[model samples]
Target: MRTLPSTGPRYEPPRPGSNGASPFLPPLPSSRTPIDPPDPIEPVEPIEVEPPPEPERRKLRVVDVQDRASLGGAALAGLSLTWVLYSRILPTEGTLGFIVCWWLSFTAFYLLLTGLRRGRVVLADRFAVLLAHSGAALVGIALATVIGYTLIRGAPALMHWNFFSQDLRTAGPLEPLSTGGALHALAGTLIQITMAIAVTLPLGVLCAVYLTEVGGRASRLVRSVVEAMTALPSIVAGLFAYVVLLISFGMRLSGFVAAMAISVMMLPIIARSSEVVLRLVPSGLREASLALGATQWRTVWSVVLPTARPGLATALVLGTARGIGETSPVLLTAGYTTYLNLNPFSGPMTSLPLFTFKMSQSPENNYISRAFGAAALLLVLVLLLFAFSRWLAGRGRSGAR
Candidate 1:
């Protein structure tokens, strides 16, 4: 390569300690540069943040004052409108018709007011509540009226002490209320029901057990038959008993035969109800029992039966209620009699239902009073049975605890 000629004087780097320092020399401190103290770290006080204010608590209440006010307003409006329509606009009406119209108007006005004040959700809820309350109220009113009317109509006969002590054997349709009592009818009813319960309870519970614990094709068949029997009319049951025992076997009408007829009605009811109750028993219990090496029979008898005792009592009550009020079967099988017959195996028996029916057919006021009195007694008996069942159920619950 050939050298080229320079254009000007050549550049030279400065020596060490001169205007610039050499790269090999160590760095030197400068007095002009200020040295600041390290930043002072002031202690930060803990943040004194107050806890968020506790939310105000409000107690929830059912049926507030506003609800009561709204209800009163609706009732007043409904009653006023009903009175105006019935008295001024309508041609004629009875108490029942006016009451029904007032109820309809009240419900409509209440729903309208609720929808206006609240929204659709609240309106729907209020409507549902109102419907439930109205249905319960109507049921209560109907029961009260029936009981009140029955007691009022039967007061003349019920007030007499002898009406419960004597039988209709010495009494006539024209006889005074004090002359005779429903002793025979009462005895017959008690005896028949007792016998029916005795015959049906064990069999029904066993059938239920078989259906629940030993379910098979046979169980399904039995269940079908039981369901069919539940719909069997009282008259059909009566007719069957009349045909089989009376016609075929030459068995005479007696309380025993009446009990047999009643059993036909009671058996299916008890079985079906017991089956439902048994099905409600937890499978866990059965598994636990089996795990403990208890046999199936022992588990059912000791564990299952005791656990379902209260429900079984309920089943008993149901069967008793169905059988006790049966008139057609008793009339067909027992052949009603006015005279008191203590022996159920031999003679005709007079039950409360039969006595009520017979007395109601008579034209005499005294007879009608007796009929009503008998009917009232039947109601009392049913109440007693219900109370007894509840007592038994409560006892079982306490025992379990």
Candidate 2:
């Protein structure tokens, strides 16, 4: 029998025949080796990859020097053109017209210069961004101007010590700045605002809790009413207080009535704002508290309300601010007075807004100055409260649920 060639899987060289060169038909070349399969590839170890570099932080100066130069040129041209138009072309120097002129000139120049340097797409983007930033800056500038002007006009009255220590009862409208202060008005405002807060906070907070935590179909109607009340005019609130307390009932127009009117204005604001804040608390927090066997009210009181404390404070402050600056409600309910009245129930009392309004209407320069001073004080107080509220919000931001 003929033996079969070795059937092993590994590659092997062809066997030589009985005689040399007799195995295959072709003869091998002298310098060539017989064909063989390539050697098996060795297994490779895994590669170690280097970590990527961190990205560089961007600089705050988004605008380049070229852009700044363009802006400067636009400003110079705008101011010059505004001056010429205001001085020579206009019939009056109430240069509000000049403001429009300057803005138009600046916009025209800015677009022209930017379009030339950059392509149209880039120019459009830059113009839009700059316009928005410029608008915001303009608002800031206007606010600063108002505050500064009020301070400058009221400097004489504010500098006097009697403005704080005494009341308008003894000081005539024509009297010198040193003789009288808005002490009574200031005191009345504080007391009335305090009373309003006393009435509004518990009710507002509870209403918010109901809307956010225990909401039902009735909550929708309540929410709609609150939203509508937010836009309710100050005069309407005043009229409601007047009709309810003075005309319908037998109550006098006193500081308590004023407080009630302010309470009306403040209540919806606080409740709506508090609802927003409470909704911002995470669902996970309530779930976690309840998961731990805490009751619903306990979860709200311990987990939700505490987490939202700062925001609630901010809402309260915002409501107080809205009521504090109001004039119409105080006018109808408080019946402006100059004398210091410690009791909210007994007699007519003045507030800062009322005092300022009465003083501004007078023909005397001293009265106008006093009005401006009171306005400045009000502005300063509002700004301080706003800043404080912002601080509270920021402090609790990291811990918010």
Candidate 3:
């Protein structure tokens, strides 16, 4: 008899546990497996069984848990050595020196222990990271101490409301904080900064745009001048204003002159910082805009500037901070006055820095307190500016989105 034509592999049932069985279950009975003989042409197929997974890896730690007790012992030894060196072993008298010495010793000891446990390579990496963290912590501690000390010293004068609303002109150095305030100085600072910002913002931003987007032979010269001005002495800026406005033209010392000097000082900072911000704007955005047939100016105005607006605002605030805290420039150009002068062209106007200097120069303790209070107010004003900038930047970013 003739056999039917072959189709494909013949259907055969899987052996027991050939499909991966649960590890928790007992082994299947051998009787369940098929024991039928196979045809000659259909070969036996081999089953693939995957091996068990390897265990998880653990990272090398800078400090091992097992060595925690040793770490504490090392720290104690370092601290004791530092105290001894600061107190009797060395000529130093400061707790700061002691802290520095202690930290150094602790770091060195920790590294030595790490090297002993791990290896030289791991020790080096750990040492570098530890050093960086220590430096940052030291900086934070220094700032906290300085700000705390200032707040403590100025608390007396700052408690009075009159100090925020009055000027040093009306109050004598011997007068109490209730009578004479830093109001006039506050007004002057506000006026000068306003003028400087008004003048500097447009000019600085344009110069930055020129440098980044339209770089050329002329731009290089401009960049060089701007860079040179970054190191321009505050005294030189003051003298330049004095010679140009007072000596040459016989103009009086006024807020206008002071603002001009401050503007000169602020311009370079704003320009350079804005340039950096603008440069950081991704080139892909610019290229995409141009590909859509938008002009260079249009791309910058619509895409680039808006994207970089927050950063540019930060640049402006930094420049304002630099100009606002200056003493020498305001001293030479604004002159010292106690009265509130709204006009930028006439009357000598004083800033917080100048007011603080004058107050501290006196022999009275009250004046010194007021001086510290003025400093505290200045810090608050700067903080306010920074906050305002941040708010504005947030708003702009939201609007863009």
Candidate 4:
């Protein structure tokens, strides 16, 4: 207690006040200097984010065209070409120039349209491409038009009965040119074609069957040889027939010899066509047939053949068309006749093609007309054959299913 001398002020616990104040509290102190609230916190300025600069607007490209200049050039070119074509300055010159002009003009217009549609600057290069295509189309149209015009112009001469019913021997230029009918030629053609079909159909079908169904190394070699034969010239076939039948056998030139020659010509065509058609028959059919205990031959006969009958018929008709229209072989082997001859072996016979060729060679204009008529007839006949074949093929295909 000696040193406790002035220990600081004594502490005392505070007591609660009557107004719900805490008991442990100090009395309010008075100060001479005013107490200020702590300085107010500084406010942050809002961020001055300038909006992104307005996006630059994209500029649109403008197409500049010298319309008047292009059109004027085009018009001048067209007019010049027209003049040249119509004036006929040279042989077929007008036709050629007109064709060229039409193509150029069409091309120009096409390019102009394209450029306008695409909003592209019309340049000469674009026009050049258009012009090229136009030129090709014009050339094609010109050729077709010329041919049609020529054929139509020649039609009047072909309308007379004398054109189809007369032979050249009885016809003279001044005498209305009527003498013999095409009946003889028609008969010869039918006989030769019939014989050709008879020989070619069996041989061709067999060859096709062997190649497709029974083919082996030997069959491949045979097919190769046949393919090579297909390219042989009609003149060569004619010469061969002439030498073999007329000279070697001391046989008269007749429809029979012509038929044999034509058969040679038709064989490869028929064989190739038939082979392709037969091979196209699905292998599943053959397999199913065999699985049913059918022999290979039976499967081919009953299943394969029936399925491909249409194609086979088409091949035969095509072969007939090929043989019936032949002139060279028939000319060399059969020899032409004015009167009808039913016998294939005894005398010279004329076919439609041979008749046309002979008629066209005569000096009389009537003969020329007759040649045209014969040509038209022959064309019609072949077309009918094709139509019939197609019909048969359709029926066969439907029936097979």
Question: How high is the lDDT of residue 187 in model 2?
Answer: 92
Candidate 1 vs 4: which has more lDDT: 1
Clashes of 3: 2
Report the C-alpha lDDT of model 3 over 281-305, residue by residue, as the tens digit.
Answer: 9999999999999999999899889
Best by lDDT: 2
Error of 2 at 298 (Å): 2.1
lDDT per residue (tens digit) for residues 1-401 in model 4: 12232334444434335336555675345353444445444455455566778899875643336544555556676666656664555445556667666556645665565566554544565666556765798799897776564456446545556555554456454455345556678778989899988999999999999999998889979899999999988878989989999999999989899999998888999999999999999999899999999999999999999889888998898778778887898889999877778899998988989988987898877667666667666776877888998898878777765
Sliding window of 10 residues with minimal summed lDDT for model 3: 40-49
Q: What TM-scores do the predictions have?
A: 0.77, 0.78, 0.75, 0.69
Output the better candidate (2/3) by TM-score. Answer: 2
Prediction RMSDs, each to the true structure: 22.4, 17.8, 13.9, 26.1
lDDT of 1: 0.87
- Candidate 4 runs further than 4 Å off: 1-93, 112-169, 172-174, 177-179, 396-401
What residue pairs clash in candidate 2, if any at all?
Answer: none
lDDT (tens digit, per residue) of candidate 1 on 68-176: 7888899999999999998679896899899999999999888877767788888888999999999999999999999888878877888999888899988888888
lDDT for residue 150 in candidate 4, whole number 0-100:
40
lDDT of each structure? 0.87, 0.88, 0.85, 0.77
Model 4 CA lDDT for position 388:
90
